[model samples]
Target: MTKEIEIEAKNIVTKDEFVHLCSSFQLKKQDFHVQHNHYFDTAHFDLKEKQSALRIREKQHKFVLTLKQPHEVGKLETHQSIDKQTMDHTLATGIIPNGDVANQLRELGVTTNTFTLLGTLTTSRAEIDYKGGTLVFDESSYLSIVDYELEYEGEEEEKVETTFGALLKEFNIPKRDTDNKIARFFKAKAEQS
Candidate 1:
C-alpha cells in the first residue's frame, strides 16, 4: 500500500512561479518529470453537495481505482488504489495488468494524466489553479510536479484542476497570483462575463 502525509492549504497558486520554485524544493532526490494528460469522463454525479466519489484512473500502461465511501472532513473513510505498470501482452487500448491490478481496475473506471516531478529546492507547500484545472508546478517535501494538471471532460460539466504559487503568511496561504500569464487568463475570462 502507498502511504503519504498530506497538508491542506487555504487557497491556490499559479503555474509558472511553481515551476521556478521546483528548483529549490526537497524532491530533487526523487524522480521528476513533465507530462500532458487527457482525461475521458462520464456523466456528472453531483449530489448538490460535496458527496462521496468513486474514482478510477485508466492509463496507457495501468489502472487505478479509489472509493470514498463518505465525504467528510475532507477525507475518505475507505480508499483503494491499484496500478498495473507492466504488462506481458499488447493492449488494444489502455494499460494491461496480468493479475489483480487488471481485475480491480476493470471493476472500476479510472483514468488520469499528469506531469510529475521531484522538488529541486522549493518550499514544502502547493497551490491550486481553478481555471486551467492544473496542479501546476508545486513544491512539497513529499510531492513536486511540473506541467501537471487534471481536467475532467464530461457531457454537461467540465472541471480543471491545477496548482499555483503564493507567499505564505502565518501558515494559512491565501490565493496569490505570481504568474502574469495565469492572471491574464482569469482576468480575460472574468471581463468577458
Candidate 2:
C-alpha cells in the first residue's frame, strides 16, 4: 500500500471555462486521458458516515484501489494496485480484496462483507505542471451529472491556495461549495434513491 498526503484546491467550472483553460495552458487534446472510478460502500453508507471513500479506478486497462480518509492536512489516501481480473471480480461479486484497505475499513467498524457497488464516474482529465503545482482539469460524467473541475496539487499549502484563488479570480469563476468527486457521486446516488 502507498500513502499520500493530498492537498488541493478545487472549483467547478463551465464547459467554456474548461476549454478556455486548456487553450490558456496550451494543453492539447492528447494531454487528456480517460479514467473510470467505480465506487463502493455499504448499504447504510458506513464509509461515507466517516467521511471516507473507497474506489477502484481503471485507466488504460490498469486498476488501482484507493481509500481516502479525512485528515487534518487534507485527505490521507491509501492506494493498492490490482489487476483487471481482480477489479472485474470485485465488481461482479461485491467482495473486496484482502489487503490493507480491508484491514483499514475493519478498524473503522465498517462491515467489509456488506460493501456494495455504488456507481461509476468517468472523467477526461489533463494534468499540467504550473506555478509550483500540478494543475488538473477534468470533465466528468456519471448518472445525470456532468461537470468540469479545476484542481491544483502542490506541497506549499499557502502558495497553492493563493495561486488557486488567483486563477479563479482571473477566470471570473466563483468557488462553488463542493466536495471531492466521490462525495458528489455518493450524494447524487443518494438523491436518486
Candidate 1 lDDT, tens digit per residue, 38-152?
1111233221122323333343444443333232223232323443422111122323334443333344443322111111222232333433432333332211232222122
Q: Backbone clashes per model, in order? A: 31, 0
User: Could you give candidate 2's per-residue lDDT for residues 36-94 as a string of tens digits?
Assistant: 99999887888889999999999998899988998888888888999999999999988
The model with the greatest lDDT is 2
Model 2, runs deviating above 4 Å:
none
State TM-scores per candidate. Answer: 0.34, 0.95
lDDT, each prediction: 0.30, 0.89
Candidate 2 TM-score versus the reference:
0.95
> Where does candidate 1 stray beyond 4 Å?
1-7, 26-30, 33-50, 58-62, 81-167, 170-193
